[model samples]
Target chain A: MGVDERRQQLIGVALELFSRRSPDEVSIDEIASAAGISRPLVYHYFPGKISLYEAALQRASDDLASRFVEPPEGPLGARLLRVMRRFFDFVDDHGPGFAALMRGGPAVGSSTTNALVDGVRQAAYLQMLSHLKIEDPPARLELVIRSWISLVESTALIWLDGRRIPRAELEVQLVHDFAALAAVSAAYDQEMAEVLRQGLKDEPGEGPFSDLVVRLVALASPPAV
Target chain B: MGVDERRQQLIGVALELFSRRSPDEVSIDEIASAAGISRPLVYHYFPGKISLYEAALQRASDDLASRFVEPPEGPLGARLLRVMRRFFDFVDDHGPGFAALMRGGPAVGSSTTNALVDGVRQAAYLQMLSHLKIEDPPARLELVIRSWISLVESTALIWLDGRRIPRAELEVQLVHDFAALAAVSAAYDQEMAEVLRQGLKDEPGEGPFSDLVVRLVALASPPAV
Candidate 1:
């Protein structure tokens, strides 16, 4: 294989091992063995374990960030739900690695690793703003978006603890969470209200926002016997 | 001063200093100077700077955990708003320390420090459960509450970066965020619905939950053109 192809192959192999166990626990020998390459060959491709681990992390981070991408073609709720689906797909696929990276496990102390994680969050934030089609969001709107992004991150972290909640439900619930956050902000600031208005303009009766309205209106009435 | 009084005084001085500047920047000499004691005398009380830092951190952590304490007498929204106020008060007062602790700065790495931070989050969780009058929350209810707690944490961290939004508004908005979270969960799960019902039982129209409802209902109508 060419140098570039060998590097990509090694990164893929390292990410797979790191996903199952922490990078710290996985040895260079094991990575080479998995790649069917000699340990010396592994060293030739990368300087050491930390460098290889970082390369793997960079790959995973890019993949994770890309999961937030969605074409701004449908209702905002539908678009967000699709994003959540892909987001959770990454979490579900890369459980231990995702948890370790977010929790800052021992093997991941470099500023480069930190930047990779931050890059994912930044990409997610910009993707969200793109969905909102706002080059410059109002402060409250920005807070709402940033808070929702953090919520998604934490939700994924907590959900990984025991896999207690069903993944599908959490995906839909998170999209609803974004709506709920936006709704609360809209209620307070007129700018947020206008943003929510534009977001919901194309939403269908079966969209997440409508589902939230239906659910909330049910809450307004007396509880059923 | 007696030995115990001296230690307490030292911890107090260290925390005050740490609160203003990152603990990594504050030296033992400064801590001694601030406490009106000699550098050698500072070591006489504690082994070294790290131990003194931990002692100070323990005090701050205990105080932070205590801020979550609230009587269960008032409306849930009002009670939660009060809790948010105190939470933000800690964040506001200990700006540098709070940011450092949350962001995991160079000064903090030991498992003990991690435990202290976790202690604060765990204390806040129990306080919330106590206010809900729940001995054991159902799964969905627990998810909503935990997610809300994370929201509060991130909000404080983000708010600290730049105090662009008004502090009072963010505090109240957080209470609304909790209501919004539980509202979304209630719409999905009967258990959460019942939980939210009990929470809103004594809430007045001006309560955060009611305010959220009023705002959400307004969104159901056409925007004011």
Candidate 2:
């Protein structure tokens, strides 16, 4: 394999192994053996295990963050559900690594790792704002969106640990959460109220939201008339 | 100090030290010196460094969890603000230790520590259910409350890392989130709808909730009358 291809292959091996075992528990020889490469080759690609682990984490975070972006082609609710579906899928595909990344601990407390994880969240935040066609949300609205993302992150972290609620319900519940937050903000922040008004008006009647739409429309009390 | 007093005192010293540095970086001699005692004296109270660390962690988790409780009084929103204030205070006071405990990295990944952390979350969960006056909330309501608590926990975790929102506003925002979740759940679940009805009806026209109540009361659209 070429140098770049070899690097990518090694990272994939590390990610697969790291998912099942903590980094400290995994050895350089083990990684090399997994790849049928010499230990020197692993070191040539990554100066040390820490560097390799960082690469793996960055790759994981990048992949997860990119999944949050959705084409602005559908209704806002439908658009958000698409983003959420991708998010849940990432959590499903990488249950262990994603859990450790989201649940940062002494093992992953470096500044770089924190930034990588925060990048994913920041990307998710920007995607939601983009969906709302918002440039700068008021602090309450910003907090509302950030808190909702946190809710999704925390809930996803716990769900990966043990499957309590199934994925389909989890998706709708998250979509409903964004709508509820928008309505709640509308009650407090006028700007958000208008944002909610514009966003929900275009909610498509053809998706999984058909059932939840009635209650959601009711949440926007005073009819926004 | 007597033996029991010495044990508690030593644990307190260790907790302070662990808060400053990760467990692996902390040493027995440092804890002993901080306590102005010999290493043997430290070992006398706790078998080893890990035992002392575990004890310190337990003490911190127990203290943090106890802070979540508040007297069941006047209004649901009012009672919740009281609980939230206590929750934020724990985060403020025990920022680092609280961070470590909640993060649950390799340093403190013992099953017992996990149980201790979960216990706190459960206590907070039960307290909110109590304020709702519902002994057995429906599954949806349970998930709703649990998700909100998770939001509070995740938000507080990030806030400690950096103080973007003031503690006071964060507390009110969290209180507002619970109300919003209650309102959202009500629209679909009949039990939650009634719970929202009774809770809002009793929300006092006083305290921090005064402004938010105007928005929340409007959330129970169609007047639930």
Best by TM-score: 1
- Candidate 1 scores a C-alpha RMSD against the true structure in Å of 2.0
Q: In model 2, where do residues sit more than 4 Å from their true spots?
A: A13-54, A72-75, A100-115, A133-138, A161-164, A189-225, B13-54, B71-75, B96-115, B130-139, B158-166, B189-213, B216-225
DockQ of each: 0.63, 0.30
The sequence of per-residue lDDT tens digits that candidate 2 reaches over residues B19-42 is 776676789999999999999988
Q: Top model by lDDT, which number?
A: 1
Model 2, range A1-225, lDDT digits (tens) per residue?
Answer: 899998999999998877766555778899999999899989999998878888888888888888878887668877777888888987787777666655554455566776787788899899888888889777666777777998888768767755866877778778878776666557765666667767766766675445565664565343334
True contacts kept of each: 0.63, 0.36
User: How far in Å is the alpha carbon of A2 misplaced in model 1?
Assistant: 4.4
In Å, residue A185's CA in model 1 sits off its true spot by: 1.1
Question: How far in Å is the alpha carbon of B48 misplaced in model 1?
Answer: 4.1
Error in Å for residue A58 of model 1: 1.3
- TM-score, each model? 0.94, 0.75
